[model samples]
Target: MHRPLPTFRVNGAAIRTIRMSAGLSTSETAERAGISRRYLNHLENGYRDRMRPGRYAALRTALGLNPDDQRLLARLPHEEPD
Candidate 1:
């Protein structure tokens, strides 16, 4: 059987804050991150508590997250350590 992707529980508020500060709309951010806007909204609104690591990294990169911002994300709990 195919294994399920691991997920990381992230801070939705922090992600939303960074995205807004970067002046990116959900649609734009999602596009940049190669994900759906609805999924991004779900993440930002905490409707979804966790995301796959690749998606998380893509979101971070799309938001242009800095070291400090990365630190903020480092507090996340993951299914597996990186």
Candidate 2:
């Protein structure tokens, strides 16, 4: 059985939540995330299944999330410490 990549989400609840909350255009986020606009689009639409750490770092920083929030976002389905 193949496991889904931690970054690839069927529903994209996390990605969409961050994007919406930041009020950033897809193009803007893509640039900040250090990915192509198309890649970011795919990630946002749940069309792609993986995001690299570099992209993750950029996105987290651009969104102004703290280290903990970034970890939570990076972990996805995994729960963080209370």
Q: Pick the candidate with the highest TM-score.
A: 1
Candidate 2, superposed: residue stretches over 4 Å from native:
1-11, 70-82
Query: Per-prediction count of colliding residue pairs?
Result: 0, 0
lDDT of 2 by residue, 3-80 (tens): 864552223457767777779887887777677888767766768756656666676776677756643243445554
Q: Who wins the lDDT comparison?
A: 1
Q: Which window of ten consecutive residues has the lowest lDDT sum in model 1?
A: 71-80
Per-model RMSD to reference: 5.1, 5.3
Give lDDT per model, in order. Answer: 0.80, 0.64
lDDT of 2 at 69: 67
lDDT of 2 at 28: 85
lDDT of 1 by residue, 1-82 (tens): 9998888777788888888888999999999999999998888788986888788888888988743455325263553368
User: Global CA lDDT of candidate 1, please?
Assistant: 0.80
